[model samples]
Target: MEYTEELLNEFYNPANVGVIKAASAVGKIVDDENGEIMKIYISVEKNKIVDAKFQTYGCVPSIACSSMATKMMIGLTLEEAAASITASAIVKELGGKLSDTKTRSAEMAEKAVKAAVKNYSKK
Candidate 1:
């Protein structure tokens, strides 16, 4: 299978693969059927995402999507983060054209982020 440089880079050097010292919310994935597992931590200040990170174990697409989403949401307000984040957005940021199956990773990343943000908003 052929992969682009963007895919390779994201898969090999994913950003935000650590945990935040203090997070308002943490989204934990406990499903393996999809083979895309991710745990995200979000730090919120004044309803904005001051910081975000995740620990994930999945294929290249999943990793890239998660990494990209984390980066995108870093300084965005919760509303912006929720509105701007999506599987298609991740794919577009990666230059588009991901396999249909691989696209789930992007969706998973979006859900994870939203879940984390929701948890934080509750607190």
Candidate 2:
């Protein structure tokens, strides 16, 4: 899939593209259909996310989505991050030009966030 200029920028210069060594929560999700995988690590303190990072193996859009997802979550509380993560929001944050085909990447990003929250809550 051809990515938009904004997505290309994000993919080429991804933010928070590493694992947090001592993450408070970690989440991974895979897209069997496309062989896409995303893993996110987050550090939370006092109910707030102090750090967020991700490793994505997939298309350009997948990397871009995860990059933005991490950037959006870093300073937010766990609850705020969870609520703010959505496909529509991801697309909007990508400058609102992502096509329908790439929405799965955003969905994957959302699933990763929910997984992190669920994992953190289990502790």
lDDT of each: 0.82, 0.89
Q: What TM-score would every model get versus the actual structure?
A: 0.91, 0.95
Count of backbone collisions within predicted model 1? 0
Tens digit per residue, CA lDDT, model 1, 1-123: 555577678888888889987778897765579666888898888888888998888877778888888999999998888888988887788777787757788888889888887877777
Clashes of 2: 0
lDDT of 2 by residue, 33-89 (tens): 899999999999999999999999998888999999998898899999899988778
C-alpha RMSD for every candidate = 1.5, 1.1
**Model 1 Cα shift for residue 108 (angstroms):** 0.5
Point out the worst 10-residue segment of candidate 1 by lDDT. Answer: 27-36
TM-score computed on alpha carbons, candidate 2? 0.95
Which candidate number would show the highest TM-score if scored against the true structure?
A: 2
Candidate 1 residue 95 C-alpha distance from true site, Å: 1.6
Candidate number achieving the greatest lDDT relative to the actual structure: 2
